[model samples]
Target: MIFLKLFRESFLFAYDALRQNKLRTFLSLVGVTIGIFLIIFVFSAVDTLKNNLQKSVNKLGSNSIYIQKWPWVNNEDSPWWKYLQRPTPKLREFDELQKRSQTALAVSYEISIDNRIVKYQSHTVEGAQIDATSHDHDKTWNFDFEDGRYFTEMESRSGSPVTVIGHDIAADLFPDGGAVGKALKIMGRNVTVIGVFKKEGSDILGISDDKEILLSLNFAKNVIDVQNASYNPQIVVRGKNGLSDLEVESEVRGLMRSIRRLGPNNEDNFALNKTTILSNQLDIVFNVLTKVGGFIGLFSILVGGFGIANIMFVSVKERTNIIGIQKSLGSKNYFILLQFLIESIVLCVMGGLFGLGMVLAVAALVKAGTDVQIVLDIKNIIRGISYSIIIGMLSGIIPAYFAAKLDPVEAIRSN
Candidate 1:
């Protein structure tokens, strides 16, 4: 009951002080408000970037591994020249892996084709990325169609000129919504649009189905030399549902070595890449960015802490007479200390809340104006509030102790 009465009295006194010195109070809190905003804003931006990059990684199939001539990251031991001399994954190797591997649920061969003009009567979308893949491409890759369906097994084997277009391609060529069944000229060859890919917006790694056109590898072989090094051929293998990625990777690595006829002593020519490599690289990058952001934000928070300390000192000086009167009324020393400390905490919390509001407002504005997403999750909110409380306690402790130690007669006479 005594503590509650002391709290109520302290809060009323703080409120009165604010009402009487509005400008002074606002000025004192500006540092704290700005500090909290900087810290939270930086954290939110890092989180958003990390999330977007992870989404891009997911689109690449987390459980799938790639067999390619070149490694995603250069291997210091093998070097780029050695990787260059390695043969690209071929259809024969893809077939051998599919036949031999027990851990692989699906195996696919894909080749990249340079930007080509795609035209549907009067409409044309230039510089569209084109890729050709084998029968199990849909199983190896993760995607959804906005319309129609994937290539039938017969269509993939027979080199049928059916194609699946991305969202942007469909939007540009068939504005009226009937993209399926229409013929579009790609690489000067007429191909029927069998399906439309669901819209997936671009990510940091430039991975999205929104700007691609997919066709069967057999059909591409008829038009161009898929075995050519310029086409960048690769094999993708997705693991079975119950198997771990390591288990699948081990089997695939051994199969590739056997298929290439590499002796036990000879180094493996092909590189096996996983989404986890990219994810680990991203983790390193984001961790550094987060630390740098926090380091810069702490300087501002330190300045704000000093400003709060100065305010607490001023508050103590102004309320000396009140402290003496409370002491004379039999109020304990801890009560005076706790009352001042709580008032400081309340003030800093109010400032932190204002800063958090500003962050929310900016995040909403940015989301409305841009394609990028900003996440101000519950963890960040709690972190901001916790920082405020710690700063308030640190700033008020010394001043609160001085207020508690003042002699009643001296404090009362000071006024």
Candidate 2:
């Protein structure tokens, strides 16, 4: 009961200090406010980047492997001519691998052609992305259909003139919602639209399916040379549910080597790419970025701490006569210390809250201006508040101690 009464009285004293010197209190809080804003804003930006990156990486399946001529990771030691000379993965190799591999659940041969045009009647979507894949592509890659279905085995093998369009294409060409069974002209050949991909907005990696059209590999041969190295033909392999990507990659590497007749001393020509490679590289980059941001924020916070300490010391001096009067009237040393400490804390907390509000405003503005999302999560809020409390304690301790130790007679005589 006594402690509660003491707390109530101390809180009132802190409030009174703020009300009596509003301008001085506001100026004293500026440093802490800017410091909190800098740190929280940096943290929020880094977290937003990480989230977008993870979403992009997920689009390329985490457990899938890509067999291609060029490696995803850059190697300064290796000559570029080596990769340029490597042969593009062939359909024959893909067929052989499917027959031999035990760990792979699904294997697909895929090639892409860009800047193509698709037309329905007078409506046209130019510069469209087109992907040609074997029938097993559905099993290797994850996707959902907004309408119709993927190619059947017979249709894929027989080079049937069937196609799947992305949401953007469907919306552009057939805004009324019934896109399936419509015939669209591509490469001067009319093909039946068998499916429409679900809507996926633009992402940082430009891998969204919103602007792509999918067709069978056999059918794509009539439009472009499927075996052309310029088309970037690659094989995608998805591991079984229980198997790890490493296990799948190992089996794929051995099989490719055997198929190419490469001896033990000869290096394999093909590259086995996995999402983990990109994810690990992203981790390194983000870690460095986060550290750099934290370092900059800490400097700002240090300046704020100094400003808060200065204000606290001056506050103690200004209240010296009041402290002496209370002490003469039988107030305890601990009460004086607690009162000053609480006042300093209240000031810092107010500054922190203002900083948080600034961050929220910036986040809202950025979200409105761009597709990117900047979330100020609860974890960061807690962290900001914790920093405020710690700064308040460290800054006010010495001043509170000085006020507590003052001799009533000497303090009463001070101007």
Model 2: worst 10 consecutive residues (lDDT sum): 293-302
Tens-place lDDT per residue, model 2, 1-415, is 8777876776676677678878877777887788778778877877777777777777777789999999888867977798889999998999999999999889999998889889999899999989999999998887788889989999999999999989999999998879899999998899999999998776655678888899999999877899899789999999999888999999999999999999999998999999888778877887887778667666666677777677778878887888899899998999888877876777778878888999999998988888568967788888877788788887778888999999998889885
Off by over 4 Å in 1: 1-9, 12-27, 75-78
TM-score of each model, in listed order:
0.94, 0.93
Angstrom error of the Cα, residue 3, model 1: value is 4.7
Q: In candidate 1, which residue pairs get closer than 3 Å at backbone N, Cα or C atoms, i.e. clash?
A: none
Over the stretch 1-415, how does candidate 1's per-residue lDDT look in tens digits? Answer: 9778877876776677668878878887787888788788888988898888878767777789999888787545758888878888887898899899999899999988867889999999988889999999888888899999999999999999999999999999999999999999998899999999999887778888888999999999889998888989999999999888899899998999999999999998998999888888878888888887777666666677777778778888998998899899987899889988887877777779988999999998998888677988789889988888888888788989999999998999989
Cα TM-score of candidate 2: 0.93
